[model samples]
Target: MDLTLHVWRQKGPQDKGKLETYPAKNVSPDMSFLEMLDEVNDGLIKSGKDPIAFDHDCREGICGMCSQVINGRPHGKQEKTTVCQLHMRQYNDGDEIFIEPWRAKAFPIQKDLIVDRSSLDVIMQAGGYTSCHTGGVDDANAMLIPKPTADYAMDAAECIGCGACIAACPNSSAMLFTSAKVAQLAALPQGKPEARKRVLAMTQAILDEGFGNCTNHYECEAACPKGISVKFIAKLNREYLKTMIPTSTDA
Candidate 1:
């Protein structure tokens, strides 16, 4: 199969980028999207032309390092699939594929399809963890947690911090990503101690990063590679509201 790839090429963050067209010949149906790109890069290198720069580590979908917008969709419109997991068979021969990087003020383009997602790392540092001493694994009967609550926590924990949610949102909101971090811990017993602090710090960090606010568009949920739901956003809101209200335990 053959494909015409319209890929964004930029030398640096300050450099202007445009879609450069290249023909991908003899593409195998079984080749992963990144593998096809490797073939293209090899051809470019042999021709003494600059290769396309895109981010990819552990092309297994778990790392979420493959961040590119394919034909205007975050991960090519495949439900619960990352670009690394996207196969060539999903497209037809003689198709034109437009690929670009994540567009957002918070995720400025570094070069080609690679963006500086370290802003997300800063937000995570703000308070995405429970610092309590969880020394050694406890037995099943030691801390009895309801199965439903544990399931919810596990579902929220599926987020891989891919930034696809922000890329998909019209407003460039990071609420879904932030809320996933918040909801994952809020649903668990170990996370209750620093619940208010975690929510407050994370919410502030997102605003500081210049990400837009969420207004119920739900695009974040649609673009998430892990299929993390927008319900976590609601959970985050409730958590924030609780922080604002005084409780019996509050001094």
Candidate 2:
């Protein structure tokens, strides 16, 4: 298949970027989207031109580094699929594809399709882990966690932090991602001790990092490659509210 690609090109953070058109010739339907880009880049290098810049690692799609907005959709039109996992067969020959980086104030464009996603790291650092001492490792069944609770935690843990939620949100909110992180820990016994602190800190970090607020558009859930649910956002809200209530210990 042959396709025309209009890809964003930016030299640096300060440089104004624009879309540059290039022809992708003889692309195989079996080729992944990133692989197709690699072929195009190889061709460019052979012609003494700078290759297109994009982020990709572990082409198997676990890394979430292969972040790209295909046409107008993050990770293309495929549901729950990352760009690296997206195959060329999904597109037809003679298609005009628009490729761009994730757009969010917190995630400023570094160059071309790569954006600085360190803001996400900052959010995670705020309170994404359990710091309490557990004394020593215990038996796997020692905690006796309910099956439903374990399932909920596992669901939230599936978030790969791809920032697709932010990209798809009208407000560019990080609520989905932040909520998933918060919910994952909050659901488990190990996370209960820091639930209040975790929820407060992470949500505050979201605002501090310049991420927008969630207005419940549900676009984040739609864009998440891992199929992270918006229900986590509700769980986050509940956790946050609990922090505001006064307990006898507080008194």
Candidate 3:
């Protein structure tokens, strides 16, 4: 199939960017979206033009590094699918595709289709871990957790920190991503020790990084490649509240 790609190009973070069109001729339906971009880059290199810069690590969709906004939708409107796994078969011949990077105040563009997503790492570092040892692997296995609780923790853990949630939000909120990190640990027994502190620290870090607050638009849930639920946001709220109210043990 042949197509026209209007891709955003910027020389650097300070450079003003614009959509530059190129013809993607005779593209294969089996080609992954990144593969198609590779083909386009190959053509540009042969013509002595600079290639488009995009983020992509594992093309298998596990890494969540392929960050692109296709035709105004994060990850091209495919439910629970990342751009690296998106295929050309989703498009038709002579289609006009608009490609851009994650657009959020916190995710400033570094260049063409690449944004500095280290803000997410900062939030994670604030508290998204269990510093307390949970003993060895076998010891952890010996602790019998309720099946439902384990499933809930695993569901929240599915988040890949792709920042698609932020890109899709009207307020550019990081709540979904942050809540996933909080809820994953909050639901686990090992995570209970730091639950209160984790929620408070991570939420503060999110605000410090200039991420907006969640107003329940649910766009983040829709854009998540892993289908991470907004229910975790509710869990985060409960966790935060617990931190504010003194418990009997504290008394």
Candidate 4:
């Protein structure tokens, strides 16, 4: 297949970027999107042209590093699939695809398709942890948790921090990502002690990092690769309130 690519190119963080055109030809329908990008880079290298830069690692779709806005959709409009998992067959031969980095204040463009997503790292550092001191592993049956709660926590924990939620929202909200990280830890008994501090710190960190607030937009859930629900925001909100409320003993 032959395709036209309008890819964003920037020299550095301080440099402005523009869409530069390149012809992608003979692309196999089975080739993953990143693989097609690899072919394009190989062609550029052989021709003494600067190659396009994009984030990708563990092309198996586990890493969530392949963050790109393809044809105006994060991860190329495939429901629940990452950019690394999208195949060439999704597009027609004469298609003109536009690729760009995630657009958000917190995610500044490094160059080309790469952005400084370390803000997400900062959010993770804010919470999303179990600080129990266990020198040895405990039996799975040692704690009795309702199966439904465990399942819900596991689902939220599936988030990979790819920033699709922010890209999909009109105001570029990071609530979905932050909520998921909070829920993952706030579900279990080991997490109960820190639940109050966790949500407080994480939400404040998100605001401090310049991410926009959620205005009841469902786009974050729609674009989420893990299909993490916006209800996690509600969960986080409830947890946030707990921080201000007195504990049972004090009450």
Per-model TM-score, in order, reads: 0.96, 0.98, 0.97, 0.96
lDDT scores of the candidates, listed in order: 0.94, 0.94, 0.94, 0.90
Tens digits of per-residue lDDT for model 3, 201-233: 999998999999899999999889999999999
lDDT of 4 by residue, 1-251 (tens): 99999999998899988999999999999999999999999999999999999999899887989889999888888899999999998989989999999999999999899998999999888886878876898988999999998998899889999999998889987899999988878887888888888998889898899899989979889888778898888998888888888888666
Question: In candidate 4, how many clashes are counted?
Answer: 0
Lowest-sum lDDT 10-residue window in model 4: 126-135
Clashing pairs in 4: none
Could you report the Cα RMSD, in angstroms, for every candidate shown? 1.3, 1.0, 1.4, 1.3
Q: Residue 73 error for model 1, in Å?
A: 0.3
The CA lDDT at 205 in model 1 is: 94
By summed lDDT, the worst window of 10 consecutive residues in model 1 runs over 131-140
Residue range 143-218, candidate 2, lDDT tens digits: 8999999999999999988899999999999999999999999999899988999999999999999999999999
Greater-lDDT candidate between 3 and 4: 3
Pairs with steric clashes in candidate 1: none
> Which tens-of-lDDT digit does each residue in 100-153 have in candidate 1?
999999999999999999989988999898886658876768888899999999
RMSD of 4: 1.3
Candidate 3, run of 10 with poorest lDDT: 132-141
Clashes (candidate 2): 0
